[model samples]
Target chain A: MGDFLETDEKVLISLCKRGDLSAYDRLMQRYEKKVYALCFRMVGNQDDAADLAQEAFLKAFRALSSFNGQAQFSTWLYRIVTNTCLDEQRRQARRPQLLSLDKPLNTEDGQLLLTLPAEASDPLDTALSQETEAEIKTLLSMLPASQRIVLVLRDMEGYSYEEIAQILNINGGTVKSRLNRARARLRDLYLKKEELFRPTVHLNRKERRDRL
Target chain B: MSCEKFTKNMGAYLDCVLSGKELSEFQEHLSVCNTCRQEAEELQSMFSWLKQAGELTPPKDLRKSVLAELKKEQGRKGIRSFPGFSYAAPAAVVLIMLVVGNLSLLLPLHVSDAVPMRAAYQQESGTVTPPADAIIYTEDSPDNEQVSEKSELSSEVERNPSPRLLVLNLVLIPLFLFFSLRFQQNRKEAG
Candidate 1:
């Protein structure tokens, strides 16, 4: 399976370099979702994720000549995505803005404008699980950008420490320390929100059993 | 292992990167230490929750939009790689600077009268006189016509410097410095 994927990637890359837009399109189709997922988790916002993911692909295409094939194409693509996200975060830091949490922030005449659905309305959103996810995202955002990137790449994306170090252009020791600090901070946050992380259904089941 | 030592190595231990003697020693500490055991359990649960959060599927339009953007970029690249296109921006900037510099030099000045007055004052006071090559065009000078031409050129440059050139120098110098520093920083970071 690995050999097949590597071969397919090599063929697509050759075609892409030759200005084959269709081949590039096929390559994007293959990895767009994964790239978007990584961006979404890193930035913690859907719109920014989409924008950053698109930028990463665009940058990858422009810099395709420099892709020396030292690493897997996906790894190189991910490094671009990570750098793009970090740059965006740095730009945003220079000009911070306050965001309102309330959805459907306004109404125009009789119609709703900018109506964003609350997590409660999401189909996949169980209350406890959604709360846990939201809390985790909040905690992740609290981390410094360097530590947050390493944590997301390591724990969430399951990239090896070496891969992450390579992606960030840092050494393994720095990666280890950053990941450890991020994990410790997150663990501390989770401890505070332990109630939200508890198994709600199991608790309900036990309560019902006791009542019966 | 001491509690402090265990705490320091807890992350590596949880990642299962510690091996053999250290791993065994950590396990023994966990077995005997209630506080460390609880800490380990909490760290394990937190990691589990993180994994469960999982990857999300991007919006359906993402692929189409990305391809569209890439096509637009490719079109731009096509235009940019055309012959002489790459040098256009730098060439334009240099051309502007040269034109502005020459224009500033050629502009008329109000300093023609002051030159002789300064020269006379310097000679009478036995102070540092103007450069011997700089012909001070006075009413009594032998080469009055030649001195007038040289004086006109020097006076224009010394007295009536173009505001546009001044503004360009002010802006471009700082911009050049800023970009130089930024490039150095980027190189440092890249390395």
Candidate 2:
């Protein structure tokens, strides 16, 4: 955190309204991580998440004048992120492209970026963990966009029901109902993947035996 | 709470958003009912997994790229709001209005000619004169004097068609347009 990070958001917003680019940059730095995190979870793709997050910040800056300070700036930004992700999802559905080949495959020096190499020594453990993570992502992608957004806001992002409703521009009851349905749907999907859970069960049993 | 009600409220309960009394009842039910307990545990486990999976670091260059994009956008806005450029639209409108107004003044004043004055004069002469009471404007009447004054003013207008009002309208139209555009820009910025 910098000096601007310690400054109040209202002060920063005021400065941004005055066309202070530094203030806007500081605002971006403060919320960029959380915004990216939300976008990544919603889209389940890093490239799309990065694009969506960037678009969201740009939109926030453009529409900063319209921000009436009714909601927290973070909430407003989250709403933008959520809407951007949803729009991206809708666009992808219409076009149905498997990969964004137009995007660069590597850095300028031909160095691969975003490679998540496993630190674990056991290849089987690494493979199992990656598979389980992939399976969860698949299950999340299976949900309707609305339900998935509510689920991500509630369970993943730890937003309150009221905050999720405000962000989605829906009622609190609707958020709760959607969250419930999303949880139930996710549980059903997880149950269907019984094999994915078997390794964890075995690991737990083996650890228990070793402790005994 | 009944098992059915508990089932409906299970998600909210896991989130700990249930009302206090409802939460207590839910906990009591969970302690007693194996089915509800298992269901709650599964939901909790699923949520826990989602939380863990959702924690991802954004790319290192995202902030840099976003800032660069913001700078570009700001530059575009700066160009738009440049003092000279911002006033250019209104200035052009004023110039156009001035040229049009001057051209209109140079053109013949055909509006007076378009009126059927000969027919009006013939009708006034051919019509029967009204009775004294019906004729509201008597010779000694102030109304009669006012009618003569109005006719004299009309003749004066026919002799010299002044473009003062036309000039005023031309000036006002551009002024209105300029102010309206400025107002709209201000509103856009505020919004």
Candidate 3:
């Protein structure tokens, strides 16, 4: 967040409008990791996040010419990313079958959780963790796409309340209320899991003792 | 304070949204309510931890894939603006107008000219008069005669259409078809 102001996003945006690919590339280089990370946290998969990020950048590039200087370029880009992710999520939700989360065994996480592979003994926990990720992703999937987006931009990406409101075309108050509700819902969901909830009790004690 | 009131203001306070006297009131409520304070503390920790989840990068091929899609769209746009397809509409309009204008000009002749000219031909050449059957219809007044003759000629034209008009129709119909077909082809190609 601190270094974000150092890059002069407005200058990069002007360069982008002039069709400077290198400038656009520089802009992407600056924001892609954060954008992807936000999508990954929301959608909970590397591939989906990558796809969402690409869509976001492409949309931003196409729309850069029309961008008024009222808002920060990163804010505009965040809006595009948020919309793109929401669209993907809505499309996924309409499909009734469970989506495949399978990845190639070559990746580290994949290597650890290849369900059909013979080497793994505790594949059930591995599969359940993957399912946990999927359930969280699905619960996020269930949120009204707009509210989920405000949460993702504000809570996950660490965008300010003002920025989230501008991106979502809502007022600051709505953004605040929605984000608060989203956090409470997520906290409730996390509490429902015994393993995580019990750990929270221990963690709370440790945190309280540490503060003392 | 009721739990609902504390809960509602709790979100606002955590985001630093409460202002002036509201902040003081919320703090006073918070000091009195351990449950609300604990809830606020938990929310703070949760969001703070979510923030620290490290940055993730998208795979390399994603950009290339999107750029290629954009290039395809640009190419489709180019195909739509191809010259023949652009000109077909104006060309068809001009052709139809030329045909219609030419057909409209073959109006009836005046009876004044027809009858006088025929009579003059008969008298000067000392030829036999035209038969009653030859004058199929007659007008009562001179002016009416002229008008009727012109109307008769136009009726004749309607009865027996002109070869020139036929030729113009022949030319335009194919050109129109070709233009329409070309437009359809261009659309298909663009798609």
Candidate 4:
């Protein structure tokens, strides 16, 4: 048992494949915290994240025979955890989006401002720095799953673009574009929640013209 | 560059993927464009906050729960992988090898090393080896008669290899099919 702690990940995986339960436990211990944290960010909760992490681990164990070592083990495990959360998200009814990132938002200043949901009464009432992680997490949950995942991976988890591409099974260009879009959306969400909910009304091009 | 076009390149500019002339074009646009510059800075600050934010601490029991779940799965996997097909397939192989091994023991069949194959038998399965260090095949033990019979059979095969080989094949084919079918059934149940 102590020897397993000293073993590398590859040897531990091989031992796991050969039905060494202790080896798998060692591997689980190495990754459980990371997986749980990822799941929490994806699912936006603690209990559900724990359950999702466990489910992902079980699924990975069952599919162990198919896990060729082409990608790193952590990468493969992250893929499973991300997929598990996405699948769970699909099972539940999603909240309707108040603002669509796809819309071409034109402000009075002629700039396309991708602002947060107007439903927030006065989010910026408090100082931006006073904004809590809990608020950001909530705001993140409101973003589309596709965009949310990219933002979480690139911004919060700090995975490189290439690593995210491999984990998401997308190409590098797709990763960049998705990450850009995700950051844009998250910025809008966070700003709307923490800084944009202020005294000024951002009139669209048509609204300004009408007023003029 | 047009702001419309710059919109597409905004990500690249922020990512620093733009270079040389392309980079100059983006910077020149941002230098003149208040909106785009302000947007970039806001996006930059927001993302920096995300990056710098401390990771949430995972629940303390997360490891324990995952391990508990895995242990339960391991038990079920053990059950499904053992008995029935898995056990039968190997047992059948050992049975055929036992015939060949026992035949070689006395008569020297085509694949020799019969002599009751205690060592090979031990390797094939623990079926023959009793739990604990109990004596096996002692002079008065009931296992002795079966051991003697295997040796007698081996001598017969040593005298006649061709006929014995044909008979072993006949016994092997049906046993193979039977074990394989049962193994599939076990797999289906497990699945």
Candidate 5:
């Protein structure tokens, strides 16, 4: 993958400027997953994430001519995604909140916490992992949109502090501080749910066998 | 580093953003201090779990929908299609209308037309008679005499065109008033 990506990005960008949809498609395919992931985690919902991602790509296409190649291609893309996601977040905030509307995430073990429907299974994780995933996502939603976005990019996306700052148009120090604060809050929330981190006890021989 | 300092710089240190010297110093301190080491481990675990959360894929239909919207936007780029069409269109129309409306004035009027108009104005005014010394320069005059005669004629026009200015003002003031009143009425109608 790295070898395929090693071709000069400027060449791809120029091709895109010349209306080469294939080159633009390649660029989109390359970053779509990461960008969507960033949007998904930041917005805390899948549908909104998809909308923001598409809008971000369209915005990037419109701005391709104005792109003076001053910044790296990925950096420019990240800025577009960040701005689009933030706009969506603002719009979502204006709309009425639909509390208790979404299905509870599924967990691994048969021991259920929040019940989920038979459908809507995601491929990325097992039931238990999905539960944990959904829990963290909910916790992240408690943060201000700015802090949530910075933390998502910095932590889950593994973006460097400078990259986060560039994407968010903030200084690196602000990125670092916000990440610290966000992570601290996350840790507090995680520690509050002690059962997730603490080892589970097996009650029966059958249960122990199932765990094994 | 004390626990306080390590905690304060934990975000920076983990991001590998501290100065090289400061990083080495922090590491040197970490080698001796157990509390900072433990804090670093906890921070590392926090970020590790976060990273492990992984990505969420967007819906398959989003690309199609957005591109469909973009295709609609292509037509809206009409405003930029012709580089100077917006500016040139109105100007060309106005210029053509002006040339067509006043083509007679732009082309020279014959002496017959001027003589009749002058005679009619004289009869109508009755206040001033044509000057006795009004010498219309003839083509038979010598070149130097023609030059002097033209200069004298120009000087006479220069001294006397104030009457033309006054005549223009007299004709235009009522026109101005009529248009001004019409403009105000149109504005009121619009409001």
Candidate 6:
């Protein structure tokens, strides 16, 4: 239980492997938020995300010995989290529950209302309004697991193509193709609603300020 | 580039992985093809927005809860990994084999060979046929009476049955169960 306040991740991992629980705790604190974010986007809810993140950490702990430091610790850990979430979705898929198909989408306005605001505020704030983020999460959940994982890892989690390929255990080419398909599928789903396209997405301090 | 080819390459194109020749061809197609251009723009925006959606902070107690859960799980696995595998198990077989090895000396030494225990039960009087391979291992008594009853021979058989098989099975089973269970668990969740 030594103070790991300034310990490097590799040292923390080595300590964890040698049975130091607090070292593992330190390692966990470093990535818990990121892991939680991945789970949240993958599952589109906080509760399941929390559970998945926890399960992923436990898995990372158990499998710590085999983590040879070949990949970055974060990448290895993200792989576990990604797989944990994907496995859970697969389990859920097996016992299909009645879905609320008619659940109201957060995006109230249709495509007609899309326009750049005259006064450009923080683009992130405008682009990621609570409803917009919620809508994005919901739409992400709709994608098939294969496509969803690639999309989430690439688009939301910001893993590199090579990193994503390693995380999913696929080749880089496959990662690109899957990511492409995931993006395409997501686009189709977005267009299906036609209202999900937030007006702020493309309005980068320039024209297209009002609906035609 | 054909529209289909352009569509397939949209990912590479967006990623800026396309080379100069390919990039020029792709832009040329996009320049002329409205559908391909619009599709690329929309996906690009959508992808960027989703990226911008950004990370959310987990609940304060997430680490606490997960740590608590990890503790509980370790407790469970701790017991299984303890010095012995205990717990009233399933497929339980209560083998109550009475040790009758040394007790054979107390009885009149009537050792029966090849004949299974059903022998020595002659119904008629004085018409008893001794088992062909019956040997006398003990020299306790002066009168080595040739025992003539079924019960005596049956008791004799139980006292001298093979010790190796029972000891082997008993020693091997728990060890087998412990290792197999551990192996199965590792296989179930291996990385």
Index of the highest-lDDT prediction = 1
lDDT of each: 0.72, 0.71, 0.65, 0.70, 0.67, 0.69
Q: Candidate 2 lDDT (Cα, whole model)?
A: 0.71
Put down candidate 3 lDDT per residue, B26-53, tens digits, no spaces. Answer: 8988889899888988888766645544
**Interface RMSD of candidate number 3:** 4.9
* Over 4 Å off, model 1: A97-128, A194-212, B87-191
- In order of lDDT, best first, we have 1, 2, 4, 6, 5, 3
DockQ metric, candidate 4: 0.21
Instruction: List TM-score per model, in order.
Output: 0.65, 0.62, 0.60, 0.59, 0.60, 0.68
Error of 5 at A156 (Å): 0.8
Error of 1 at B104 (Å): 18
> TM-score of model 5's chain A, to 2 decimals?
0.77
Best by TM-score: 6
Q: For candidate 1, what is the DockQ?
A: 0.26
Instruction: List model 6 lDDT by residue over A68-130, tens digit each.
Output: 988877788888998999899889878956533213323333222333223222466544466
What's the alpha carbon RMSD for model 2?
13.7
Cα lDDT tens digits for candidate 1, B2-38 = 7988887788898788999999999999999999999
By summed lDDT, the worst window of 10 consecutive residues in model 6 chain B runs over B90-99
After TM-score superposition, the amount by which residue B68's alpha carbon in candidate 5 deviates from its true location, in angstroms, is 2.7
Every candidate's DockQ is 0.26, 0.29, 0.22, 0.21, 0.20, 0.33
Docking class of 1: acceptable
Give me the runs in candidate 3 sitting further than 4 Å from their true place: A1-11, A95-139, A195-212, B17-20, B75-191
Ten-residue stretch with the least lDDT total in model 4 chain B? B129-138
lDDT of 6 by residue, B1-191 (tens): 46898898998888787988989999989999999999999988887667667458777787787677667766776655644343223223322222342234334334444243444344322335443322341244332333433435655565544464456557656755775676556644632
For candidate 4, write residues A1-212 as lDDT tens digits: 65554448889899888767688888888888778878877876667888898888878776777889888888998999889988887775466534543233454564343534422223544443323555565667767787788778877787887888888888988887787788778777767764433324477678779999
Preferred candidate (TM-score higher): 3 or 6 = 6
> lDDT tens string, model 3, A19-100?
6666777788877777887677667667678878887888888787779977877778877887788788779778875534
Runs off by more than 4 Å, candidate 5? A1-8, A94-119, A123-128, A194-212, B15-41, B75-80, B83-191
